[model samples]
Target chain A: MNKKYNLAVVGTNFIVPRFIDAAERSGYFHLHSIVSRKTQSGLCFRSANGYDSDVVIHENIADMLNDDKVDVVYLASPNAIHFPQAAACIKAGKHVIVEKPMTSNTRELLSLIALAKANNVLLMDAMKSLLCPNFSILVDNLSRVGRIRQCTSTYSKISSRYQGYLDGNNPNTFNRMLSNGSVMDLGVYCIHPFVHLFGSPEQVHAYADLLDSGVDAAGIVILKYPQFHVNITHSKTCATTNSSEIQGEDGTIVIDNISTLTSLKFVDKKGEETEISAPQDPNSIFYIAQHLGETISSGLKESAVNTHALSTKVLTVLDEVRRQTGVRFPADDR
Target chain B: MNKKYNLAVVGTNFIVPRFIDAAERSGYFHLHSIVSRKTQSGLCFRSANGYDSDVVIHENIADMLNDDKVDVVYLASPNAIHFPQAAACIKAGKHVIVEKPMTSNTRELLSLIALAKANNVLLMDAMKSLLCPNFSILVDNLSRVGRIRQCTSTYSKISSRYQGYLDGNNPNTFNRMLSNGSVMDLGVYCIHPFVHLFGSPEQVHAYADLLDSGVDAAGIVILKYPQFHVNITHSKTCATTNSSEIQGEDGTIVIDNISTLTSLKFVDKKGEETEISAPQDPNSIFYIAQHLGETISSGLKESAVNTHALSTKVLTVLDEVRRQTGVRFPADDR
Candidate 1:
């Protein structure tokens, strides 16, 4: 018999409704509750998203963590709150699928991992791209390109609220106090695919154009590996073509977006183009939700795909880049 | 009356024939002579490229400079030899068109500029992209994009001889001792376009993956300006998509092959794609040759388009990037 996992979500921002849709779409998971500072909005969000009337609406993290029916906590909160909120859920013996970046720094992430392990609960960073069916095809087809030599990933979109910031309003996306910068918000998308394709880099060099708030508005990060190099560029002040290229000696892989692994094209040395697509649902989060359900049902405490070690490595690289570029958050003081 | 310029090319390599073709194609210039270490090969090259039978084949630079009929010395020498060769031509009171990476560093370039001024001869760095008619349109269209925010230029082609280097032959392109690396050979195409568009950057941060020959096999350079950032990636070990993107608040300009500037597409914020193509000769070098012809005939000591100031700025950025990445050449010591 298949076990149905009850899921609760923390944070009610633009991503919360998407999580609710993903949870409801995955047959093995139930959207049980949502934690938001505004309980009325959470209730409204649940009703709008077609969640049952019985779905719990908690006004705070404590009330949500105290709920005994929640088996997994989906965290899509601000960067600064990820650690403490995920830790509370782990301490409560709940599995977790925290959003990208997972925490502000590597240390907090490590602590959360330790707590999750002590309680024997699955803890996975929701890097939805890795769970996409096309990612495996990319990994498998890498050899066709021969030895990997160079990779470039670009993920830039003008934040809808960026104009407000340019006009002297402070938005959380550009606020260092909120632990948000171009790197934390957009760079993680570029970094994850890089770290996934190639393990930890030997060195990381980053340069940025800082916003008035002293956070990176746009930047480039160079990851040096033993034989190949990767260039990752991200920005919130501008929109990019949103294409990425991985060059190997024999062929190259062109990806349309790092956020979603939907469109892929492979060009060989002779310039023959082949489109590579995999079957998957449009909502990428649904795949991750399904993966989490299977892993927890099988009594596994970690995902083999988005492993703890990979998350740690990605966070370590991000931490060093932030340190080099002078992007500091209040949580770094601890 | 139009003054016809007689051109004498120094060094007989792959690019020498192209210069011959451009000179022949441009009605204002004549290919009068060729200089090569092996005079027989120069004779063969002149004959093969359909040069006049009367074209003089000189065995040395001094002989070519002494030919009073040679009004311009087109230098296509090895990287380490560009400084002294161009300097000799300037001292001999002849206008010169030196190939890219005009000199190993900015100091030598400045010295050549001073010499050109003292001799009152036009000196231009043969960066073909700047002379391309399409480039001017890009510069003109910059306002449509609004305030520039981020730019990326990639020019990577796997050297046909790279396999020879991997199999243990140090070709001139990979040999650090000969003042060769990915930056000098390939990155100049990326750097020249960036400098031509943005002037000089306020700061440069570079990271390279060095080969066993102690030269950068590939790298990324971040050029920081007050309001925006530019990312340049170049490689000799692998081929790239060979495209560039300049993003502004209102639109973007996509360039195909920064080396040639053949195809350009302008996309506005509304996602309307407009292809902007300018009329140019099949051989892009024809534009630079004609520009040099007009500048010299007008008694100017430098080109207003590919100015000495612009070449100096480009070399300055390249030198700093080389210094930061530890790409040392024997010429740097002198």
Candidate 2:
């Protein structure tokens, strides 16, 4: 607690500033710098996040890394650039936090993890759900349902940018080059909690509604295990009841929302329902940032929560989904 | 309305009595005879369904077929015997109503339809969902959801007999010899409406959790259409919220129960929700019986609602599901 880690954030996407805010509020991190592709964007991101005159601004990763004060680099850039940027930070011996879907494919993710290990820097995926306390509550209550029979995790919501894509405009969300399809953007949330709770499945069967741009508008990915089946339903072009469920022989667990573990309950065979308390904290990133700061202080080389192995399995499922559905990405296999 | 057709009812399963009551209530059919493998069971079913002493009880299909007064034969027998039994009735010039999942596989269904055509008799599947007033209400409101993007229909319920099977007893529900399983017993309800509303998809990807008895306990079938995707999620090992949903570019239609369709509503992008009126009738067979009686009275050889084409498509999807999941049946390919 006596020593605060200096943090520098890249990318001015909406999530970046919010992550920085949470990181600073955790009190283990001081926002030392802001990095952006353009000078004005860096300033805008700085002021929008309420950074005063003392916060340094850098136009490039090289400039930020050259000044060694940034003890941890948070890469929240577009998916295509995540690997290269995270690699640069790890090579510079700075602890790294790569945003959800740490890389476009398994190969890239594994390569980045190897690089982080070679450099002895703490590397982790900013998959917040597992790091949050509510997720633990859900996992802990899994035994009440008896033997698992099947589970379904759905994270389908109409994206704000979909209207533009329909109106003859190209949105990054529907673009294959950015690796921002429904599965990558929303389905990863489904895959993580699913794989984390029940390890990797024995097989995967997947299908997606491909946009003209070759990215999935929506999709269903079924994971097959020896004892049960898990269905991960994700979409960007539509909205649904969007609750995730775990079905068992004796009862069922219903999760109100997936990305944010808002509230969960168990309904036994006799139809008795008990609500399990879960924080409705709108900011999932705050939990991830706190966990990341603690890990950095603890001097770990990788996150024990969002382990490299968990991220690998999640991206492995994503890889199979894109393979089956033909949602190709530029960063795939690179 | 004055001419009540003599209806011969087969199968003593729980759904059989409900169907008989509905058929009699429709006022277009009079219970003439009851058929079962056992004489006491046939008499028991006849008395339990309120059939008078004058209503004859037969212990075999041939005796029921031989009764010249039997105007129509309703086959609710085990799935494996549906095709053979329906063929016997159609050949005897009796109008026929085959229960949901008219046959074990697509091939058997097609063969029975062709035989019915040659015999010049009315033959139809009693897929009650398409025949119900609530289903019509749902179809009428489909346009309110805008251009469809994805749809998911789930029909999952733990069977009452599941406990007996789990306790080292081989219940008929989990038996492959009788062509009984979760997908056949429950998932057919999910697929019938999905195929009816959206037609057959261009491709299919299916998976199931197979029991030691070589039948599915739970499964998912993904139907891929050019414009959208339809997921037919079904189970019998567990229970779920079990709602059906249609996602469109602008809105979504949510059906509370798929088979019975207790209620439905449309929720638009603006979060404005409108409830669609649908009868909460537990007896879906009532609608099917009323429609079947009307169709037979109209002298139609096939149901205009649960058309030959719809049944063919539905059975085809079920076939693929069983094939993919390795849940084979004694009635398959016959």
Number of the predicted model whose TM-score against the real structure is largest:
2
lDDT tens digits by residue: candidate 2, A93-194: 899899888999999999998998899999999988887777888888999888888898898889999999989789877888888899999989988988
Q: Which candidate gets the maximum DockQ versus the true structure?
A: 2
Minimum summed lDDT over a 10-residue window in model 1 chain B is located at B19-28
TM-score of chain B of each: 0.96, 0.97
Give the Å shift of residue B272 in candidate 2: 2.8
Docking class of 2: medium
User: Given candidate 1, what's the lDDT at residue B304?
Assistant: 89
Clashes of each: 0, 0
lDDT of 2 by residue, B1-334 (tens): 4579999988888988898889888889888888989999888877776779998889999998988999999998889899899989988999999887899988889899999999999988887777778787888898888888888888778889889988879988898999999989988888888888768878777888888888898888888887888887788888887578998888999988777777888999876888886554577789888888889888889888889999999999888888888988878755
Regions more than 4 Å wrong, model 2: none
Per-residue lDDT of B204-246 in model 1, one digit per residue for the tens?
8887878889888888888888888789889888777647889
Clash list (residue pairs), candidate 1: none
Q: Who wins the lDDT comparison?
A: 2
Query: Model 2: what is its DockQ?
Result: 0.68
